[model samples]
Target: MSRYDWNDERHALGVATMDATHREFLELARAIESGPPAEFATRFEGLVEHTRAHFAAEEALMRETACPSLREHEADHARVLGDLGRFLQSVAKGRPAMARAYIASGLSEWFDLHVATMDAQLAAHLNARQHAG
Candidate 1:
């Protein structure tokens, strides 16, 4: 089985761009989780980069839409990105143990919650606006 499979129920946001970016997130997570120790840092870096871009894109959409929960959503992204940044620093120091543990345990759980809550709300708002306009 893949290390971190993205389930539709949990991962799909009903917004094409968001869903596609989320799929990439899961794929990168899976790659990092299953990659060899020697390649773990690099793989993790890729995930970090993908996440940075993903969050930025989402934030832009929220701003464009004037999402009601924009502040909260951006806060959530900031918190996670901060965590990822710290983990990246650790990986750069050749100390990927913490990062690996986070990938194997923390990340999937966090993604599930984030997608279900913040992302779902954002998607709903976006959809409503699309239908209204």
Candidate 2:
């Protein structure tokens, strides 16, 4: 299986929305990585767009729920978004080599860690809040 394939044991956090979004992210990344060369730029653009919306939704959740890690999580999201923006620029310019490598490896590795740590914490906090309420 491709590195971008979603593994429920590894990626699922028991939060329905978050889990679904993460699953979609993996699917999109996999598509971009495996799509035809001619479609690489277009697919990558779609991933970038999806990521923006995904991060925004998570940040919204953090805000509405008063998540303790809001600042740190927002910073992480900003960092990734900045990187994606730069990569998208390159891809748009017909220079996709570096971006392709990043999508193939860097993104997958980052996603795994981010989900296990940041997202896991958020999911737990959300669950606790729900139960407490």
Candidate 3:
């Protein structure tokens, strides 16, 4: 595993797509943490774009599967996306340090909670569907 990459076996969901996306997320996080003035915009924007798409995809899956706790899960997604968006905006406006701090602290916490609860719920929901079918 890379510095920012999570182990696949440890993932909340064993879904291939989600696992791949999560790996990308961690890679981007590591990239941003690496620090380079010229590449900041590219890396940061990539992170933002990937994160939005990932959240939307997950939300759509949850909605389609009729996960019982989807509302709470989506709310958490919204919270994380909102914070990330703000961090991106801050960085775009010339505050990379602040964005770095948010990723290191705020985002790390969010990821832990998201993986432990929402993501795990998603995994269970999908696993049930697979078994039922």
From the highest TM-score down, the ranking of the candidates is: 2, 1, 3
Query: Which model is ahead, 1 or 2, in terms of TM-score?
Result: 2
The TM-score obtained by model 1 is: 0.96
- Which residues of candidate 3, in runs, are more than 4 Å off? 1-3
Best by lDDT: 2
**Candidate 1 has which clashing residue pairs, if any?**
none
Comparing 1 with 2 on lDDT, the higher-scoring candidate is 2
Q: With candidate 2 superimposed using the best TM-score fit, by how many Å does residue 64's alpha carbon deviate from the native? A: 0.6
| Candidate 2 residue lDDT tens string, 1-133 | 8998889889989999999999999999998877899989989999999999999999999999999999999999999999999999998888999899998799999999999999999999999999999
RMSD of each: 1.0, 0.6, 1.9
Clashes of 3: 0
Error (Å) of candidate 1 at residue 52 is 0.6
Candidate 1 per-residue C-alpha lDDT over 43-87 given as tens digits, one digit per residue, 9 for 90 to 100: 888999999999999999999989999999899889989999999
Segments of candidate 2 deviating more than 4 angstroms? none
Per-model C-alpha lDDT, please? 0.89, 0.93, 0.79
